[model samples]
Target: MTSPVAGAVAAPASRRPAVALLGAYAVSLVGSRLSMVALPLFVLLTTGSATRTGLVAMAETAPYALSTALAGPVTDRVGTRRVSIASDVASALVVGAIPLLHATGHLTFTALLVLCALAGTCRGPGDGAKYVMIPTVARAAGMPVERGIAFADGTSRAASVLGPLGAAALVGLVGAAGALTADAASFLVAAVVVAVGVPAAVAAIGPAELDADDPDAAGSYRARLASGARFVRRDGLLRSIVGMVSVTNLLDAAYGGVLLAVWATRQGGGAPLVGVVAATMSAGAVIGALTAAAVGHRLPRRATFGWGFFLVGAPRFVVLALDVPLPVVLVVLFVGGLGAGTLNPILGAVEVERIPEHLRARVLSLMGSLAFALIPFGGLVGGLLSDHLGVRTALLVCGAVYLVATTLPALRPEWRELDAGRRRAAEVPAPGSAPAPAGAR
Candidate 1:
C-alpha cells in the first residue's frame, strides 16, 4: 500500500498553487525590503542617532525571534493557512499605523518602537507558516524539492532587488513615511493573494496530530514545543547548521541594519546609495538563485554549501572595510550574492528531506528561531562597534569572524551529511515497490 506521505506527494500535480504561494511570498518580501530601507532612513533622518536606530531595529527583531520560537506549535495547531492570513492582516494594521500616527503629529519614538514590535510579533508565525507550506506545494506542482525552493528563493531575491530600488525611489519621491504606506498596502495584497489563490488543502496537509478528537495524540502545547526542540537537539547536522547560521545572521543583520546605513550617511549618499548597494547584491543573488534552480540537484551539497558561504560571507565585509570605489564594492557584493544564492536551496532541501512531515512547522520554526535569535542584538552591536572602533575596523572584525564561523564547521564530520539526502533519495524504493536486491546493482 502507498504510504500516506507518498499518496500525498502523488496528488495530481498543478502549478497554480505553487504560483500563488510564490506570488504571495514575493509581494510580502518586497514590502519587507522596502520597510528595511525606509524605517532605518526614517529614524536616522528624524533622530540622527545610530544608537536609537539600533534600538528601534531591536524592538522589532527581539519580539520577532521570541515569537517565532514559540509560534511553531501554534501554527501547527491553528492551521498554517489561518495563522498566515491573520498574521498578515495584523501586520498591515500595525505597520500602517506608524505613518498615520506620524502624520497626525502624535507619533512618539516609544510608539514607533511598540508598533514595530507588534508588526514583528505578527509576522513571525506567518513566515513559519509559509515555510511549512513549501514542500507540500512543491510536491503538488511536481517540482523537485530543491528546484521548488530555488524558485522560491529566486522570487525572494528578485523582490530584494526590486524592493530596495522601489524604496529608494519612493523615499526620494514622497519621503520615508509615504514609502511605509506602500509597505502596508503590500501586506494587504499578499494576504488577499494567499487567501484567494492558494488551495485550502496546501496548508492543511499532514496527519492531524493536533486534532481535538485525538486528545492523547494532541499533547499540551509545551510538550509539542519541547518535542521539536528535542529533535533539533538530537540531530547533529541540524544543530550544526543552526549554530553556524545564528552567528552569521547576527553579523548579516549588523551589516544591513547599521554598517550600510552609517556608510551611506557618512558618504552623503543616504538612502539611494544604500538601496543601490543592496540591490546590486540582490541582483547577483537573483542570478545565482536561477542558476541553482536549474542544476542544484546535480551539485555536491557539502562543497556547494561550504564554498557558497565562503564566497558570500567575508568578501562584502572586506570590500566595505577597504573603502573601495562604488564600482568595486558593487562587483564584490554581486559575486557574493551569487554565492549567497546557492545556499538556501541546498539548506532547504536538506531540511525538508530530513524533517518528519508531522513536525514540519514546529521543527522549521524552532530552527528559524535559533538562527535568528541573535539578530535582535545585531543592530545594537553594529552601532556600538562603529561608534567605538570605527566602521572600517568593525567591518574587518566582522568579516574575519564570519569567515571562521561559516567555514570551520565544514571540516566537521557531521557536515558530510549535507549530501546524505541525495543518497537517501536515490536509495528509496518507489511507493508500493519492493526494495532492489542487495546485489542487483
Candidate 2:
C-alpha cells in the first residue's frame, strides 16, 4: 500500500521531495561525521586520558539513546517536518556554542559534555524524523522502498567519506574548534534546505492526523509508547535484529570513540590518518551502496545479510591490532565498508514493510533505541580495555566479540524471515492486474 503521506501532495509525479530529503540528510550527516572525528580528537588531545574521552562519548550518546526512544511518540504527534527543522536549528546552536565557548576561554570539560549531550538530544529526533519520511518520499518518487533506502545509504556513505576528509583539513588548518564551527554551519544549511525544498503538506501530516479513525491514534504518550514496545517484543525477527545490533553497536562505539583515537595518536598520524582511515572505508561503502541500489532487490536477503555482516565485522579490528602497513589496513577497511554498505538497505526495507504505517515512527524509534541501548558504554569499555589490556589486545578482543555477535544469529530460523516479505510482495498482484504466472518473481 502507498504511504499515508505520499498522496497528500497533489502535484504531478515528481522526485522533488525525495531529492530534497536526501539532500538535507546528506548535508547534516556530513556535519555530524566532521564532529565525530573532531570531537574525539579534541577530548583526547585536551584531557590526555582515554577514560575521560570515553566519558564524553557516554555523555553524548546516553542522552541520544534516551531522546531517540522517547521522541518516537512525540514525532508521531508532531509533524516530521517541524521536528526535523527545529532539531537541526537547535543542533546548530548547541554545536556552535562549543567553539564559541572555547574561544572565550570559558569551555570546560563539564560544559563540553553538557553541550554534547544537548547536541545528541537534538540529533536523535531529527534523525528519526528524517528516517520516518523516507518511505513517503520513496513512494512519491515511484521507487521501491529498498532502492530508495539504498540511495539514502549511499548518501550517508558519501557523507562519511567527505566529512572525515573535511574534518582533517579543518582540524589541521583551523583546529577542532574550527571544524566544529563548520559543523554548525552545515546544520543551518540542512535546516533551511528542508524548510524550503520539501513540501510542507507532505511532511507535516503526522500519524495522528493520518490515522484519525483509529483509537490508538488519539492515545496518550505512554499508551503510544507501550503499543510500539509491544509490537517490537512480539516480532521475532525484529527482536533478534535488535539484540544483535545492540552488541555490535556497543562494540562499534568502543572502536570508533576510543580505540581508533588512541591508535591514531600512537601512530603520530593524528587527525589526518584518522580521516584517511575513515574516508577509505566510507569510499568503499559508497561503491557498495551504489551497487546495492542497483541490484539489491534481486539478491537473496538472507545470504546478503549473513555475508555482509561477516565482511563488515572483525577484519578492520584485526588488521589494526596486527599493526599492518597503511596500505594493507586501508584495503581491509575498504572491503569491510563494502559489506557495511549493503546492510542498511536490507534492514530499512524490512522494517518499513513490517511496521504498520500508522506506527512507523514509534516502532522505528523503539527499534533504534533498543539497537543503540548499549552504545553509551562502548567507549568506556574500549577505554578500559585499552588502558589495562593494551590497545592491541583490546582490538583483538573486540574483533572476536563482533565476529560472534553478528554471525551466530544467522543460524536462527527467524532470520529466514528476511526474504519472506519480499517473496510475499512479489506474489501479490497489483490493483486491476492479473496474477503473475507460477514461478514469477
Candidate 3:
C-alpha cells in the first residue's frame, strides 16, 4: 500500500504529510479491495449461492449511504485523523471476528451480514476523511495539486492491483477465511500508520474561530450538509458527475458485487478465476494511472472523460454476455480497465480544484453518499437477475444501460461548463493559498 512518490520533487520534510496521508489512505483502500474479493469468495464458497452473496453485498453497502451522510459534519468537527483512526480500529476488530466466529462454529448468515454492515459503516466516514485531507496533505508537501492528485490516484490503482492478487494468493495459501484475516490486519496497520505518521498539526481540526472567512463554517450540521448539496446542485459540472457516477456506480456494484462471482461460479473456475479477472483490470488501471500521471493535464477533459467511461463500462458486460473464453474476457477487462484508469485522476483534479477546503468533507460526503445511494439495489437486482433471467441476459441488460449512461455527458451542452468553470477557478487563488511555484510542473 505504500509507494515512493513518482513525478514530484520535494524536500523530505515537506513530503512527509502527503506521504503519510496517502500511504495511510492506500492501506485502508487495499484492505477494502481485499475484502472485495475475500468476502464474496467466502460467502460463495460456504453457501454455494449467488443469492447469499448478493445479500451479503447488500449488507456491506447499504449502511454506507447513511453513515457517510452523518459522518460528514462530524468529520469536519472531530478531525479526519481521529475519525480515520477510530473507524479503522473498529473495522479491524469487526472484520477480524468473522474468521474467529467461523472457527468457533458460531458464525451464522445473520451474524455475518451484521458484521459486513458494520465494516462498511466504519469505513464510510474514514473514506470521506481521507479524501478531505488530501489537499491539506498535498499543500503541506509543497507539491503541485495536479501531480499530487495523480500520485494519489496512482497509489489507489496500485492498491487495487495488489489487493485482488494478494487476496487470491492468500486464499490459495490459507483459504478465504485467512484472506479475511489479512484484510483485518491491514486495517489495523493503517490505523497505526495514520496515528504515527501524520503530524497533529496537519491532521487535527482547528477551532471554529479560525473559520471567520469560510461562509458555511457557523452552520448547524444539517445546514452544513445541505450547503454542500446545494453547491453541487448549483454547479453544472458537479451535478453532471454526480448524476453520471450514481448510475455507473450502481452498475459497477452489480459487476463487482455479484455478477463476477456468479459468472465464476457458473464457469466452474471459482474464486481464483475471479481474482485473475479482477487482477487484469487492476493491472490495466495501473498502466492507465501512470499514463494519467504523466500527461493528464494535457488531455482534453470532456472527450477523454466520456471516452474513458465508454472504454471501461460497456465492454465488460458485452464480453461476459458473449460467454467468451476466460482469456478473451481477461483481454476485454484489461482494455476496459485501461480506460477506467484515466477517469478518477481527471475527476479528482476537477473536483478538488473547485471545492473550498472548509466544505470539502461535507460536500464530498454528500456527493459521494448520494452517488452510491443505489448500490445496494444494484447488488440485490443483479442477484435476482442472475437467478431469474440467467446471467447472460442480465449482463446484456446492464451493458445496454451502461452504454447509454456513459454516453450522455458527451452529447450534453451542460458539460461545456466544465471548461468554463476550470478557467474561472484558475483565475482565483484558493482560499489561504499563494501562487504555485514556476518549477511545480
Q: State how far residue 362 of model 1 sits from its true place (Å).
A: 1.1
Alpha-carbon lDDT, every model: 0.86, 0.86, 0.81
TM-score of each: 0.85, 0.85, 0.83
Report the Cα lDDT for residue 408, model 2.
Answer: 83
> Which of candidates 1 and 3 is the stronger one according to lDDT?
1
**Residue-pair clashes per candidate:** 0, 0, 0
Sorting all predicted structures by lDDT, with the top scorer first, yields 2, 1, 3
TM-score of 2: 0.85
Per residue, candidate 3 scores C-alpha lDDT tens digits across 55-151 of: 8987887787789877977787778888888988999999999999998999999999999999889989988887777766776675545556777
Best by TM-score: 1
Q: Name the lDDT of candidate 2.
A: 0.86
Per-residue lDDT tens digits of candidate 1, residues 362-424? 899999999988887788889999999999999989999999999888789989988887799
lDDT of 2 by residue, 1-441 (tens): 343443244346458888899999999999998998898888887779888887787788889888999998888877788889999999999999998998898999999999999999999999999988887777666667788899999998898778877998999999988889999999999999899888866664545455773457767899989989998999998888899999999999899879998998988998789868877888889988989989998899899988888887899899999998999999999999999889999999899878876777889988998888888788889999999999999999999999999888889988988999887766754322455667764
